[model samples]
Target chain A: MIRLRAKISSSRGQSTNISHKVGTWSFSAFVILLLTVIFFPGLFAPYDPLELDVINRLQAPSKAHLFGTDEGGRDIFSRVLYGTKDSVGASMVIVLMASGTGTILGAIAGWFGGRIDFYLMRMVDVFLSFPYLVLAMALAASLGRDMRSAILALILVWWPSYARMVRGQVLSIKERLFIRAARTVGASNFQILFWHIIPHTYRTVGVRASMDVGYVLISLTGLSFLGLGAQNPSPEWGLMISNARSYVLASWWYSVFPGIAILLVVSLFIYAADRFSGAER
Target chain B: MAQLLQILDVNKTFKSGNSKVKACQEINLTIGEGEVVGLVGESGSGKSTLANLVLGLEKLDSGSIKFEGVELEKLLKDKSKSFRREVQAVFQHPLLSLDSRKTIAWSIAEPLVINKIGNSASRKARVLELLAAVALDEGTASKYPSQLSGGQLQRVNIARALALEPKLIICDEPVSALDVSVQAQIVNLFLDIQKRLGVAMLFISHDLAVVRHISDRIAVMYAGKIMEIGDTDDICESPIHPYTQALLSASTFTEESDEGREKLKLFRREEVPQKGCPFSTRCPHAIALCREEEIKIQSFASNQESSCLRAQEIFPNLAKK
Candidate 1:
């Protein structure tokens, strides 16, 4: 810990500022570029992702079609660029839901304790007992395969971990003397939980939420990859990859680019989350 | 002068497993307006438990605490929140008592904000005023608790307690966790605040010297019972209860030579006899009756009493206030 602080101080004393470091700039640039592609896919792609050209099926990379075309003759590159929206968007939504629900439950459970904590934490434990992907797949199968079902299943399988994390954080903080003093000062339980209590858990929750975003992306993509996500022709990255399975040997461009797209976006989030957590100490 | 607070036969008991621990047993005390009553005891002597009871942070198992004839629970039931604003507490641990994530300004302004004392502009003004009152610099308000020293954090804690202009403050070992130098400064600050604001206080501490310097009257406890209660000087010079005599003698042994040490021999603990005097197992003057019969509090002077059955026999010449 002392060494890290000394290294940070010495680096600042020298010429290389933290933001100007190569690793920081490159990671930041990659994130910014992914965001651009999500919000402005039209700007990046000349060809429409859904515009089918069955005539040019199984074509590899060329000048006119950089990532070539899928078996449906849809342009792979434009679709991959467009599919950035769901992979990033769904993960963010799931994280926000998980963190929000988890924090509230955890705060109440930890603060009030006794029976509320007992039942709530037990339920969380039950949800957590299952491996996340298996649970997500089971829920998707039961709820019927669609984007909304996939999201619902993911949120159900995910919120318990966040609830469990924030609950643990809140448990530690509620024991602080200020919380008891706050109660004495006539701050209602609501005010004490939110103002004096929950904010203390934010740093940990931020780190956890960042890490969860990556896991959510992976789970959603894996579900879609197994034909449980947005059905064919929607250009969602996972569905796109699933559609390319038959032509894998003939047209490696089809599965590989979309696969890289998923891998790149997931790592970007994980890296950001890792750095976010490291700075908290 | 009005009696500001009254704790009448207040009882609190905790069940550990099969047996019960009487945290506070039939405690009776009163504080006049602007009076500082120091309740001193060892770690398991229930001083903190009594502080919690008076603060209404814990529920009393059997008896009642009242402020100006209104019961504590009734005061809490009303929606006005006047009772809450009127009572505030400063805890022992400095850093633990202030929210680490919040700026000092926000912490000091907490009670005012919770009670809705004024609009944002006026609240900020009061926060600044309190910061000055606690002897903190204006720039200190912007910093988090971690950025400040223990003494600085404690000053902020005091400022927060003082924000509502509370009528009674419960200070639970507020300076025990501070340095010896900082302890004097904070104690003096507390005395100064009490003089200026005329807020009554229930100061709980295990330090006899700190209690003696600031308390108008002192109550000494042993095993969840008040062993001695009287005017500060009267009790210090001639403590009626053997427990108080042992305490005063113990403090003297720390500073003086071995000359007066044998006057009060410290008692060793035995099993707490549930039906008799709580101190019977440890009292040097204990008779068979003391171990078998319940000991009731005997009053001596104006508003002073002790639970020891031997109070009159031991200190017959003790002067009345």
Candidate 2:
């Protein structure tokens, strides 16, 4: 009976391992396909994203137009494919810049502590007290209606969370005995910060940065949807959705495809971050 | 012998809200060149605080710590690199003393790197030599702290401490965290290193037996004050202070007569007196004078000193035993 039970448990473990492998392979494939879409939209796009065919305007999904045509008779599939760069690429840049700035500021604050920590943390608090979207909207509006302004606004508002997190990590890590050991071995403050303290925060910062990509994408598109980002004719995901709103009742395929594109890409990034964080544990 | 490190009337107090704990007070001690002075105390005895003070990790409130005729504060401010290179430390937890992310070779080479002593090739060679000195194999250098056993990690810590050929090394309970079996090996390794390198050491631990094995002299501390200090043989055989006598009688390795054990009571947790000896509250032979008068360490003909006022009368009886 014991032997039979052992065999059953071993088979169950094998099945779970196989399923895990399958999940990992498919996730990798999806990421590769998304990357290709962002970098070379011309490869899979059947029609010129900007070319118009007014005679077939508002056409539903058909053989010639896989995702049908917008009110301008532009191919929804091609537009969504091209919009990947402006939406997802912009989000990636924003996450990287914010995390980089935050890591440096937080490391300095936590390492020096005292008045420096107090002042820097107060600055972070000032940014954090405001509602993220409201602050981003105000900053975006003041900078004028463009994707660059929207991205800059998001970066300013997003960095404080990273700074706060990295600071917390540094506070705990600085107390570790190895840091004291480093000091006894003649390491200066700067050397200790860079070599001893900062390296320990990388795994945490990397996980947070990956997770922030999805949120930044949603915020960037929200700005575009509100007419404060990407202007018109830019093929940005949120601008495409905003344009399709007028004809949504008559032509559902136009907005639905782009919306699905946003959902799929956002979920993919979040899932990847989850897997990365889990892999270490 | 030339004095290597002198700590005179040093004091440190930690204040949090309304309570104040004196971690070190009027602590006078000296380590000579190529000397091993064991500082043994129970938990909360402030031996670690003194180690931190000598390592320049904490500021002294009153007294001066002179290392080779230079004030500690001046050495730290003007020639910190040289000062740090001359004095290194081995902490209690070996794994905690090493950077977990770095390999053993990198950890050992860190001091050399900071001081810019040699190129990467020479540093690597030095790391190998250090590993062999600690009885660790060459392959141990490539492994991380987590991959090795506690004893191996301690060997790595010792190797790192020895990388700069420091003149003095402060060991803060370096072997207290290891297994009982492994503790002997590490203690022996410290003895071997001291014999070969002739580096001065201030070894701190609560275990008297371990300290006696490796220390040339012994100092017993209680409540941030040294109760007695002398040659290891003098302390073990004729401890004048009631506190030191209790410590020696309590150690498991020492075969004490049942009558001697009965004479010394187990240490009780009593509030330390503010004006008198710190151990007077729990002393087996404390008189009114012990609690009322400010007691100082009294010297004896045997080259030992004790803080107990009655140590002169106590010593002859202890000698007869």
Clash count for each candidate, listed in order shown: 0, 0
Worst 10 residues of 2 chain A by lDDT: A15-24
lDDT of 1 by residue, B128-162 (tens): 89989989889998999878998988899889999
Per-candidate TM vs. native?
Answer: 0.90, 0.92
Which 10-residue span in candidate 2 chain B carries the lowest summed lDDT? B312-321
Please provide, for model 2 over A1-281, each residue's C-alpha lDDT reduced to its tens digit, 9 standing for 90 to 100: 99866765777665565555665566568767877888999999998888988998988999998999888888888888899999998998999999999998999999899999999999999999999999999999999889899999999999999899999999999999999999999999999998989999998898788789899999999999999999888889999999989988888997899899889888988887777665534
Give the C-alpha miss distance for residue B2 in model 2, angstroms.
1.0
lDDT of 2 at B167: 97
Per-residue lDDT of B45-136 in model 2, one digit per residue for the tens?
99999999999999989999999999999999975479999999999999998888899899999999999999999999999999999998
Clashing pairs in model 2, backbone N/Cα/C closer than 3 A: none
Residue B174 lDDT in candidate 1: 93
lDDT of 2 at B201: 98
